[model samples]
Target: MMDSGQNKNETTCAAAMNHRVTCNTFEPEGVPVQVRYAIFCGQSGIAEYEFYLSPTQHGCVDVQLDWLQSAYHQVLQWLNLELASGVFRRFLCSDPHNQAPELEAHAFSNPKHDDPPCAVSWVGQPPLPPAKVVLWAQHIDDPKGIKIKRDGATLMLDRGDLSHHWTTNATGVRKHSSFDQTQCIFEDYEQYLGKHDMTLADHVIRTWFFVRHVDVNYEGLIVSRRELFEKRGLTSKTHYIASTGIEGAPPMDRAKVAMDAYAVGGIDNKQVQYIEALDHLGPTHVYGVTFERATAVSYRDRKHIFISGTASIDPAGNIVHEGDVSKQLDRALENVDALLKQCGASLSDMTGYYAYVRDPSDQGLIRDRFKAILGDVPVAVVVAPVCRPGWLVEIEGRAIIAENNPQFPVF
Candidate 1:
């Protein structure tokens, strides 16, 4: 749905030890814009990095950085970037297995914005691992004001006072059951949107939920989300937000669930398109869940597509290739292909990928198979459980396509 006169290009590569990186460039109105993302995996932990660049007047470049890691320190040194400013969201995963590292953190920094984000001092401290902190930078025009709010382990970032909203869990908790905790999270999210004069049903585009014991509790999580969506009048026919729910612990010891979300205000409904995969995959709601398989945001000159966490499920809502990892992966990739083609895109347009594997031993096999199918597209493989116990892996990715490109037919 993008207009004419824009250009986009993508490139990907892999470094030593299975580190992958990608660069996506866009040219709109004769201005060059670029984004780079890297994923590094090690024996100790895994890390993901993102950098954004835009040409600006006054010879000063506009840049933003976002980093996520299971364990920090090493990744910072590897990237050689300063971590002086930004906000950090931490979570704890895996309680019984002290052997598996539980601390995971995401930091964002935007140097051109208002003052850098500062640490919010809290009173009591829990007997848990220290929270890993980092900074994130973003590119925004002169803004009226930027506000930060913290409640217990939750942090909210209000950019330009109302244009953008981000909410994430700073630590983990276990005071309530998983269902109760999830409901509370959504309630708090709705309240935040209300204060900003926005509603979750119309503005939210993407959401990530990390739950402890995902295999056993994913259905309950889905039920809670569906109830919230129904209350807001957002159904499968009207379109639901894209989301990912995976196995991971909150930074706190007893917390069963944690969530992060992104929303953009003041956009026309026509610019946002909810996509289905050309009759090859079933709608998520038929299985008692509520989410879009993919969502496309059409700008004046380009279209940005976000694909959700996908596996080898067929149109009947049944898992295919029940016990074969290779076949499951192949079918998963085919599903993504269909989704992209429906939106006038192909695998070559992908910017980056995050592939989650349930078994650590299957990492190499998945990696090779992924490279064989998509060439060198940037990919980060992490050892995490999927929502279903029988599912071996899940993959998510993003793509940007130019409307004027004659090689691709407009959908």
Candidate 2:
């Protein structure tokens, strides 16, 4: 017979979208690791999770209370650990660290798709005590190494890589989808949040939504997305968030939706603060005309450029050299060149970028163009329709400047 209050693996189903959650027992325990299947389904991800508990886990309460409280608190401590550690630093610090955008979120999203969510408990607990962090999110695991905070500014780097393996027929209908869009996104996201200590209302700053067919159903998606936010008593504005939604292709031939997101918390740490650009821009030499944005947050001696999505658009926002991907590519590189010069940086300073092509059939042509202009750099390309029906290409990026500038305009 089962213990009256103990949790069985089959006792209750986790919330929906948690498909195939598994809990492993620790023999000579330090920290218990919980593995979820397909937490994030794509190229770069933190697919598995390691969870550690406070020494107090086994001391108090009968079986039921112990299970509930310990699960809750242990999750909280993990999130703080992630935050203290800073988000990007965690990925960079990992062994065989893959700086590729998609690879970054590999270990965090698992159990690709299961109904009613999956969850499990570890048998043995950690011997060490838990350290407390103020104003933390409990739903997400260890924040020690997963946060970006400076000058009173707080940014939470949750899993940022997601992709859809999608293929379009002549009519543009997605023939096969590896996973449903909403289920995949919410499942992985909620699981990450579950291990953190913050309520849904805190720690989420802005969201960048990349949809496979953003151009086709942009308004409908936003309305539905906002409804979900409303259920939590969080409005878009109160979150102090901004979003850029764009269309892009998924990684494989069966994905319906692919998304990458960013969330920030806390205020600027100092009156004179600096912010770093979090997105990736391609290398400058790759295109005939390069493009970049001028807005940045400056702190200390470094500058972070938060660039907007650019395409073959000229200074007038008019599409340049349409129907000729090669010339358009050149024009794009030149734009980037101008922006780098304006910011006192150069092509070598580019951190990362997102390149969207109108047609995947032209990938080879684009690749050659990239090789010619930008040189080989860390970049990811997507095939998607542009925001404007007339535009055939678009790109955007992030860059850094080493010294504080006295001459640039703020905002």
Number of clashing residue pairs in every model? Answer: 20, 103
lDDT of 2 by residue, 266-348 (tens): 22323122121212233321332111233444433345454455557654456778788777766666666666665666665
Q: What are the TM-scores, per candidate, against the unseen true structure? A: 0.66, 0.42
Q: Stretches of candidate 2 above 4 Å error?
A: 1-207, 219-244, 249-259, 267-294, 404-411
Q: After superposition, how far is residue 393 of candidate 1 from its true place, in Å?
A: 0.7
Best by TM-score: 1
lDDT of 1 by residue, 1-411 (tens): 111222211121232133223332222233322223333222212222333222222221111112222112222333443343234422222232331221211232211122334232111111111112221222211113235554333344553322445565522243377777778888777777777667887888878787777877676678888888888898976889988888766545566776777666665577788989847799998888888999887644346678899998999889999988888988888898898898888877666666777886776688678768776455555566788878898888777665433332221
lDDT for model 2 comes to 0.36
For model 2, the run of ten residues with the poorest summed lDDT: 162-171
Using lDDT, give the best candidate's number. 1
What are the RMSD figures for all models against the true structure? 12.1, 19.1
Model 1 poorest ten-residue lDDT run: 121-130
Deviation (Å) of 287 in candidate 2:
26
